[model samples]
Each structure stands twice: as structure tokens, then as C-alpha cells.
Target: MQKKQSEWKWQWTKVYDDSKWLFTEWIYPNKLKDFKGKTVLDCGCGCGQHLNFVAPYCKQVTGIDLNTPRIAKKNTRQHKNVKVVEGDIAKIRLKKKFDIVYSIGVLHHTDNPSKSFNNIKKMVKKKGKLIVWVYSYEGNFLNRTAVEFLKKHILLRLNKNFLWVISNITAALMYIPIYTIYLLPLRFLPFYQYFQNWRKLGFKRNNQNVFDKLNAPQTFFIKKSTVKKWFNPKEFAKVHISHYKGVSWRGSGVLK
Candidate 1:
């Protein structure tokens, strides 16, 4: 089972305090203009950071995850008007559908993103919205190689005791480029852009036992065309691709 089930929840519950850019950059700006009075659903609402951002704008917000402890831990956030439930985002049964149903960096981890997303679609009222930001295959050869290596080998081989250690080390190292650029302003620097958002992946690493949970078999990838086509049949008008564009398709759309 993915560690996100139990171990991950207990291990990495309080990681959403920061990472505002991740939530805002990926899915927020594109979909949020319509959110002021909407009912929104955040699937795989990890530490509730993104949920926290969206909660105030919507009529009511519901966050669902498979990990019970994580849900309880988020109660510590004491976010009013936001309900945290322990359930599979992919298999949730809700009485009320939403005006917006979205997942951020979540679908890729599912055994079948298609089924999970389609299930998400069922939760949205007609003409509602769906937004998702997934892993991107867009980039240079070396960058892709390194990311694939870490996902395939390093993470899978990590044991519990050393998992957190590895996450810390990696997370710290990812900041080096940021600091280097900050300390020295250069028009052109190697790995500058690559490391700019390095904190996003690093944040994922810094939290709990995520190094183990990131080892999901389905995390590999999907093409942009494939994802676009999948949603097209379901009344979703293609929105835009963010993370996985050019190489793969991590996109957002509105259900028509």
C-alpha cells in the first residue's frame, strides 16, 4: 500500500504551513477566479495547505484522503468551514457534488488516474470545473534523468529510519542553487531555473515518510495528448497544461 495510507499521514502531517507558490502557481490562478462562492473539493488534500488557501473562498470545502491520522492531524489546523474526512480521494461517496473538484500533484500517484479523475468528474455539478497539476516530463535530458533516478531507485530503496534522513539531505541540497543565485546575481547560471522551484520537490521530500510513499507504481507518467483526450470525452473542455506540458500533460479543464 502507498505509505500515504497510514505511515505517511502519521509521519508527515504538518507540512503545509509554507509552499504557497505550489498551490497558487499550479492550480489556483487558473481556476480560482471563479471560486469566490463556489463549492470546491480538494482530492488528496495532503497537509491541507492548498485546502487552507481555497477554504475561505468557497461556500464549504471538503478534503478527503485515505489516511485517518492525517485527517485528524489537519483538525489541528482548526480551519473553520473546511471538513476533513478520512477516505480515498479516488473512491469517495459524497451527498453533495461540487462546483469545482480538483487534485494537485495527486492523480499521478493513483493506481489508475483515469478512473480516479473520472470519479472526480462525477462529483462536479454540470458546468463545474476540474483542475490538476501533475509531474512534468518537460525539460532537459539531464534533469529528467536525475528525477527518474531518484523516483525509481533512491526512493524505493529507502528504509524508514533513513527515509527521513534522505529527505532532509536532499531537501537541503536543493536549496543550494537558490542560495547561490541569491548571494550572486548572474545573468546566466547553470541549474538556476532548474533549482528555482526545486523547493517544490524538496518540500515533498521534507515532509514525513514521503520518500517511501512517492514510490507508487503509477507515478511514472502520461502524455499530454492522452490526458487531454481522456477528459475531452467526459465534457471537460481542455484548459491548459502546466507541469507536464511539452513532454507530458498535466492539465486543467472545465466540464461542459
Candidate 2:
């Protein structure tokens, strides 16, 4: 389990160190509102990117991850209100609760995503919020199927160095053609805007994205209904579940 988790640490550390941009807000819609003065907990926080984004608005932001605490700490070093801790989402215990417990693109990589969801839920204060985003089975059906097989039969078995090389190669194959199209006058078309975002991310970040997707050992593509069940109506006041271009499951709700 530790080895499997360490793979993600190495991949994300490389990405964080290499990428020129820093993401601050939720990538999906239904973003949090009125975070000012609230306490936030970012479970599986990678390199403290989101923590740095939220720290200025919230009273405090705590970032926890099974690996990469050192990177996270260094990334958020300038923010006195931000704390970085090394811990697993499924096992870490804290006495305090936060106004918001957010775990995006993290839970589904766990050995048991449902267990991690329950553990994260415990960190939310009563009437507070729990936000999550997981890879979805409904969207990207064909592409996901192909990658799933590669992940199980090839990528997971490769050494870290070899896997990194293959991931970058895969990124090149994907980006070259798509970005070529993006640069043409076709980009002015309505639907071309979708692929335009990828071009805007630049080559290295796109490579990192692909690496993170294919290299992880425990990537579970979950169903929307399964995610809805994860948030029991008894525990949450209202739950909102949606998807982004059929690629991810986005959910947010206030704890009861």
C-alpha cells in the first residue's frame, strides 16, 4: 500500500516542480461560496496548490496527504495560516473539525474510496460542507476502458522511471495533434474551445496530467449513484451531484 501511494507522491512532486502555473479554485463548477473566515481542510492536498489558493480567503487551511508533506510545506511556506501534515485520508484522526472538508481527485485513488469518504466526512463540522470530485465511469467510456487496461496490465507493473517516460510519450502523442488543431483558425469554432483549454495548459502540465492518470495503481472510476449513496441524506442537508464533460463526478453538500 505504501509503495502504491508513493508512486503518486513522486509523480505529483515532479509535476508541481515543473509546472509554471498554480491552480487556486475548483476545476469543476459549483465552487464554494463565502469561504472567508471559515476553516478548511484539504484532504489529499497535492503540493499545497489549492491550500495556497484558499489560505488568503479562509481563516485557516490545513493540507494533509499520505505523501508529499515536505513538498506541500515548502509550497505553502509563505502562508502562516496554512498547515501541512503527512497522513492518509482513511486513517488520519483529528480532534478538530473544519467548516469545509474538500477532497478533489484524491479519494478514488485510495484502496477503498468509500472508506476514505467516510473518514473525510468526520472532519466536517456540523452544517459545514464536504466537497469531492472523483473520476466517473459514465463519461470517456472508450478512452477510460483502454487506459484502464493499460493501467492494470502494463503501467502499474513498470518501474517508476520507465513509467514516467511512457507517460510523457503518451502526453506527446495526445497533445501534438490536439494542440496542432487548436492553433489553427478552427479554434475560432464554438466546440474548439473545449480542446483550447488543454493547449493553454502547455505541454509539461499536460504531460503531468496524463502521467497522473495512467500511472496511479488504484484509480477507480465510480458511478454517480455510488457517489450519491456515499453521502447519506441523514448526514447531509442537501446533496448536489453532477459531472464535467462526463470525465469526473463532482459533488458538494452541507453536513447535517
Candidate 3:
């Protein structure tokens, strides 16, 4: 699984947009200012981008992933204070807990998302923050419908390269109506922003989400209430859901 995940990272970087706001500017940090001087643990930290988001604010930021040691080493070296480790989020040995533990767009990919949350709990301190982002079923209809159609009929049968072209073509046109609604002059609105993500722009996803190519493994989408049900108010205070729209479920929670 680790080897596969490393390959996945490599593939993702190839198409994944490094300059997109998805990595740099987060929806909401749940008292973003509170992150300063606090300990943070980033689960499923790919090539080490999110760590850069909170690194300046936190006293220490630790990123763990199943990516190759070389990539991890490179990330560690690039960021003087950042610490990157290679390991499965399901099983890892850590002596200390963190003030904030986050797993973004990772839980739903697992065989058992609830189990992933359970394991993360062991590494989070009492009254600590737990941030997560997973696919949502009742979030947006248009986006969900488009993705379902794309994945089921379009992506399933077509090769990754072909699918990339189709998805982006569809995404580029998506900006038209959006720009119109924004009241921006349709002629002036830059469609380039839609492709600027670098992923769709470059027609990439080299190894990330490779599972989609293998057989389109079973994926799950949960409701907001279901996520809230996972935590007891006594031990975990349910923070407000951050409003985020992504290719998938974007911002969901900041559990405390």
C-alpha cells in the first residue's frame, strides 16, 4: 500500500496544480490565528504543500505520508523546520500527540474512514483540533452529478489521458456561466483561471488517484450529519463546517 501510495503521489504531482488556492489558501482554519506556536500533525500529507500553509504559524509542523523517502527527504530539506515522515496513517508509532491533527481528502479513500479517524484520535491531544475533508453526498447537486457522470461513464471506460482532456474541456466551459453570474462581462472573463490549476491545465495526474484507473474502486460520500455523529460533544466539540467547493468534498470540519 505504501509503495502504491508513493506512486500515487508521483502521479498526482504530475497533474496536480501546485499554485492553486486549494493548497495555499484554505477555506477556514478554525480560529486560524490559534495555529501560531501550536503543534500540528498533517495526515496523508502529499509532497508537502499543506504543511507550508500552516508552517509559519505553528511551532512545529509534522507531515506523514506513504510517499518515497527521497521525496520526503527533499520536502524536509526544502523547509528548514518542516518534518516529513513516511508511514501509513492507519498504523504509526509516535511518542507525542499534537494540538492539531488534520487529514484532508484522505479518509474517504480508505476502506474504513471511521477507523482512520479513530487512529488519528490516538495521536491528538485532549481538547485538540481535528480537521478533515471528505467527499459529501448532499453538498452540491450540479458538481456531484457532473462528477458521477464523468467517473461512471466517461472516466471508467476511457484511459486517464483521454479522461483528462474531457474533464478539462468540461471544466473550462464551466467558467462561462460562473463568470456570467459574477456579473463579469462574459467576453472579458478569463477562462484561464479555470485551467490555471496546473493539473487540468497541464493535463496531468501522473500517479495520484491511480485507483481511479485500476477499477474505479468503491468510493463513499457522507452527509454533514453523519460526520457530526462520529464525535460526542463531551469529548469532541463539533466545529462549524467550512464552506468549500472542490473537485470533491472540500472543507468539512475542524473538530475539537
- Please report the candidate that would top TM-score against the real structure: 2
For each candidate, the alpha-carbon lDDT, in order, equals 0.63, 0.77, 0.60
lDDT string for model 2 (1-256, tens) is: 3333677677766777333232322333434346788999999988887787778889999998887888899989999999988888888899799998899788888888889999999999999989888888775565467878888888888888888899888878876667566578763443354455566677777777788877777788888888899877988877878765446777888999
Which parts of model 1 are misplaced by more than 4 Å? 1-4, 28-33, 68-73, 140-154, 175-194, 199-218, 243-250
lDDT of 1 by residue, 115-135 (tens): 787787788888787887765
Which pairs of residues clash in candidate 3, taking residues 3 or more apart in a chain or in different chains?
11-206, 11-207, 11-208, 12-208, 15-204, 15-205
Candidate order by lDDT, decreasing, is 2, 1, 3
- Model 2, runs deviating above 4 Å: 1-4, 17-33, 176-196
Q: Give TM per candidate.
A: 0.75, 0.85, 0.70
lDDT of 3 by residue, 1-256 (tens): 3234433553444443254356433434564567788998988776665776777788898888765434555655656668888777877768899998888776776667777777887788877787777766664454356556656665666655665565556546645665455345443333223323434332233223333333233356666666665554655765545434432333323345
* Candidate with the larger lDDT of 1 and 2: 2
Q: lDDT: which is higher, 2 or 3? A: 2
TM-score of decoy 1: 0.75
